[model samples]
Every structure is written in structure tokens, then in C-alpha cells.
Target: MKRIILSGGGTGGHIYPAVTIARELENVEPVEILFVGTPNGMESRIIPEEGYRFASIPASGLKRKITFENVKILCRTAGSLWKARKILREFKPDVVIGTGGYVCGPILMAAALSHIPTMIQEQNVIPGVTNKILSHVVDRVALGYKEAKARFPVQDKCVYTGNPTRPAIREAKRDESREKLGIRPDDFMVLIAGGSRGARNINNAMLGVHRHFRDTPGLCLYHVTGTRDYGNVLKELGEVDERGYYGSSSRIVDYQHDMPSAMAAADLVIYRAGAVGLAEVAVRGLPSILIPYPYAAEDHQTYNARVFVAAGAAKMIEDKYLTAQELIQDIEELHNHKDVLAGMAEAAEKLGKASAGADIAHMALELAGKKGER
Candidate 1:
């Protein structure tokens, strides 16, 4: 059996892709996949829930500004490298792959130092500091966007393999998904999400959107409020409508377990510009109104969203200028023009790489096979 180690963490953005990649690898190959991540990251819980073998390693991110805490982090990172190397020696993995996050930095670096084939996946247009630094050493650099290649120094090593997502995303059926959710065909089926933690600004704007569409029929809005803001969001939503704006056709919740089905049912997506979310959107050919989180590292989310805008797949709404009025107006324009929406969906469909996970799985196995040949 070919052995592989996948390392990534810090957030679901990093963890989910690694999980998807592993799932794809296991589907068609006799592969022994191990996930190496820090216990403190989302991967600790998520990886285990997915029934994958997960190993924890000590790691942390370095602050940009030099300070006492940064000095401490530097020491910790140095220490983590030894731990990562030790894990590598023990596991004897044929290949190592990193998606992103600081947790993967030490592990990927160690793999390269040990002369084991290593690859890092970049999920955004503007390359992150961690991925950018490791791109020089890794055997391959898998990218989510074609525009991202220019940001990396090792151009030849970079390949546009697209971003991987859950297999359910590809197999979801729109009619079945809509029926499962009790969403009417007339309802617009707008998906508004800011990830699991929720975005306060986006939530604030949605308060107005609810009132704006309160009486509008065929507006099937599905909102994921996120756990952090669920309580307050519910309380305020009550002030706008005693029924809480939720009925058989429209609903808002702290979380949705069936995101794959949700993607299938959605007619439009209004959310942050995370690569994973956009990948799902593109695969579904959903036209989107992307509101990028301005505070993301290096403002990478904005750069990522711009790629969709340039492709006519999505519209960019910078967070700094985002408001209920702006959001409502854009939705009105798109909803009123069905042809335009269809055109945008076609553009997004052109950019979808639904087989991304399987493709990357084959790539890693090929590299491992080459090493075996040598």
C-alpha cells in the first residue's frame, strides 16, 4: 500500500480540503492516509469525525511584527520541526502534502529536508506567506486558481489542479435537495454564509435584507447565521417579524449539516470569498455576490474574489462598502434579469474543476510511484 501524509489546519478552510483530498485518495487506491495536524486546530475534531487516522504535532504561526510573543513563537516553530521530522521517520510516508495553515509549514519543510516528495496546495489567488515560502522546496504546487501562478517563484512546479471539495457536492441533485429542504421553486434560494463563526457585518446587513424581502414571494432565502451570532440574530429577527421570517419556504439557522444539498438547491450565493466555498459554487454553476473579508491575511480574499469577477462568474462587493442597500440592489438586478444570471452561471461552470480531488490524488500517487521506481 502507498503511504501518504496530509498536513494542514488552523481553520476549516485548511482542514476540509485535506479531508477531501484524503477521501479521494482512498476511493480508488490502496493508500494508507494519515492526517498530521495540531490538536488546537479545527482538524483535531473534524478529521476524527470523518473517520481518518489523525496525528497531532506541535506548531503555531509567526507574527509579522517582531515582539516577545513572536520570539516565543519562533522558538516553538524550531521545536516543531524536530517533532515533524521524527513523525516522518516513524511513519515512513511515501509522500507528504500540505494544503495550507501554519501547522503544515514545519511538516512540509521536514519532508523536503528528508528528501521525501512533498507538495503544497494553494487555495487563493494571492499566495499566502506560508505557501509562498514552501513553494520553493516542495516537489509540486497545486493551485485553486490559474491567476495564482504568477505569485509563486517556482513557476514550473505550479499546476492548476483546482480546489477539492466533498464528493457529495458533485452528486447532489437540485430537485431532490430542494424537496428535502421544502424550498419552493419560486423562492430565490439565496445562500448567505460567513463560515461557521459568522460575520457580524454580514449579519447586520441581512437584518435589512429580511425586511426588504419580507413580502416578496418566490424569495427562498436560506441563511446560515453561524453559532457565534445565532442568539442575537434570532432576537433581532423577531423584532422585524413575529414569525421570525421562517416558514416552510424560508429558514435561518446557526448551522446547516447538509451543505452539499444546500449548494445543489441554491440559485445564488452571497458569502465570503473563501476558495473552498467558491469552488463549490463554481462546481454548481451558481452565480454569486462575493463579499470578501477585508481583514484576511494579505487581503487575499479580495484578490480571490476578483478572479471570479474577471470571469463573469461572480460580482465583488468589498466589505468596506457593503450594506443592506447595496446587497438588496444587486440581488434585485440579478433576480430581475434571469438571462444575465444564466450567463454568469455558464461562466462559473466553465471554471469548475469538479474532479479536482481525484486529479490531485492521482498526482500524489504518481510522484510516490516515481520515487519507488528510483
Candidate 2:
């Protein structure tokens, strides 16, 4: 079996791509895939659930500002480098693939020092610090955006493969999804998602604006409030719908695990512009209104949103300017403009790389010079 160690986690953006790439590799080879990530990070749960072996290392990010905690994190990271080395030695991976997170730092560093072939996948237009640092040591860098090449130190080693999106989202058919989601053929369906954990700002805005949609004609709303805010959201919705107000027009889900069905059923998507969400929206050709998280590392979510805006695929509403009234108006205006929505969807489709997982998997295999064995 060809052994591959993939490292990344903390968020679905980092973990999902690693999982997608691993799944793709399984199709071509009898693979032994090990995922190395921080124990507390989301990958610890997500990776193993996907039926892959997962190893945890003591990894944490250093704060940008000067603090004792930052120093302590740095010391811990150095120790993690040693622990990661031991794991790599015993597993003897043929190749290492890092998706981009602090967890990748120790694992990729160990792989590099061990003289193992290493590759990094950068998920944003502005590469993360982990992938940027790995670029110097890794054999190849796979990028989500072509423009990312200029931002990386090792431009020559980079290839734009786009980000690997969930297979369900990539292959979702519009009509089939709409049917599955119980969306009427003529209904103007709007999808509002705040990501897996849900965004507090987004939930608040939606609550403030719920009345407008309740009164709108022929408009349907599918609201995905993250699990964290589900109870509060349900309470608010109950208060609003108590008077028979929403008229068969809204579905409030705490979380929609079947996001492809939601995306496929929607005429428009309002979401945070995380890298994974952006890739899924683009692949599904869904025009979106993006509200980027301002506090994201290096303000990368804004950069991610700008990519779609530049492509005429999405319109960005800064978090600071977001209000329930403003959100309602924007949705109403967009819904009224079917031509623009269709145009944006077309533009989004143009930027889609539906087979990014297969592309990156093939690249990793080529870097390892391994023939298919599965």
C-alpha cells in the first residue's frame, strides 16, 4: 500500500479538503492514509468519522501580539515537532500532504526533515502562514486561486488546482436538489447559512429581518442556523410565526448536514465567505451575498470574498454594515433582479473546478511517482 499522511484541521475549510483528497486517492490506490492534527481541533472528530486513521499532536497557534501565551505556544510547537517526527518514523509515509493550519506546521516540518516528499494545498487567494512556510520545504504547492502564486515565496512550485469541495456539493443537480428540499418550481428560494457553527451576527441580522420575508410574495427562505444558536433562533421564529405570519414560506434548520441539497435548491445563497463555502457555492454555480468574518486570521475571509466579487459571482456585505433591514432590502432587490442573479450564477460556474479533488490527488501521486494499486 502507498502510505500518505495528510495534515490539517481546526475548521471544516482545512479538514474537508484533506478528506476529499483522501477519498479521491482511495479510488486510485490501496492507500494507507493517516491524518495528523491537533487533538482539540475539529479534525480529530471529522477525520476519524470519515473512517481514516488520525494521530494527534500538541499543536496550537501563536498569538500575533506579544504575550506569555504566545511564547508558551511556540515552545509547545517545538516539542510537537519532535512528537510528529516519531509518528512519521513509525508510519513511514511515502508522501505528506498538508492542507493549511497550525497542525500542518509540525507534521510537515517533520516530513520535510525526514526527506519524505511533501505537498501543501493552499485554500485561499492569500496563502496561510502554514502553507507559506511549508512552501520553502515542500516539493509542490497546490493553490485554490491562480493569483495566489504571486503571494507565495515559491511561485515556481505552485499549481492552481482550485479547492477541493465536498463531492455532494460538486455533483449536486439543481432540479433534483430542489425536489429533495421541497422547493416549489416557481418559488424564489433564498438560502441563508452561517456555516457549521453559525455566525452570531448573521443570526441576529436574520432575526431582525425575518418579518420582511414573512410578508414577501412567492419568496421562500431556508435558514440554517448553526447548532450553537439553534435554540435561540427557534424561540425567535416561534414568536414570529405564532400569529400565522410566515404563510408556508420558511424552513428554519439548526444545521443542514445535507448542504448540497440546500445549495442546489436555492435561487440565491447568503453566507459567510469562508474558503470551503466559497468553493462549494462557486462549484454549484449559486450566486451569493457574502458576509465575511472580519476577525478571521489575516482577514482572509474578506480576501476569499473578494475573489468571488471580482469574478462577478458574489456581492459582499461587510459585517460592520450588516443590519436586518439592510439584509432584507438587499435580498429583495436581488430577488427582483433575476437577470443579474442568472448572470452571477453563470460567472460562478465559470470559476468552478468540479474535479479539484481528483486533480490534487493525481498531483500528489505524481509527486510520489506511485502507480495505481487499488
Find the candidate with the highest lDDT and give its number: 1
Off by over 4 Å in 2: 239-245, 370-374
lDDT of 1 at 328: 91
* lDDT of candidate 1 over 125-176, digit per residue (tens): 9888899999989999999999999999889999999999788998899999
Best by TM-score: 1
Local error of candidate 2 at residue 144 (angstroms): 0.8
Minimal lDDT window, size 10, model 1: 240-249
C-alpha TM-scores of all predictions: 0.96, 0.94
Q: Report the C-alpha lDDT of model 2 over 227-267, residue by residue, as the tens digit.
A: 99978887776753542234477777777878888888888
* CA error at residue 27 for candidate 1, angstroms: 1.8
Candidate 1 error regions (>4 Å): 239-250, 372-374
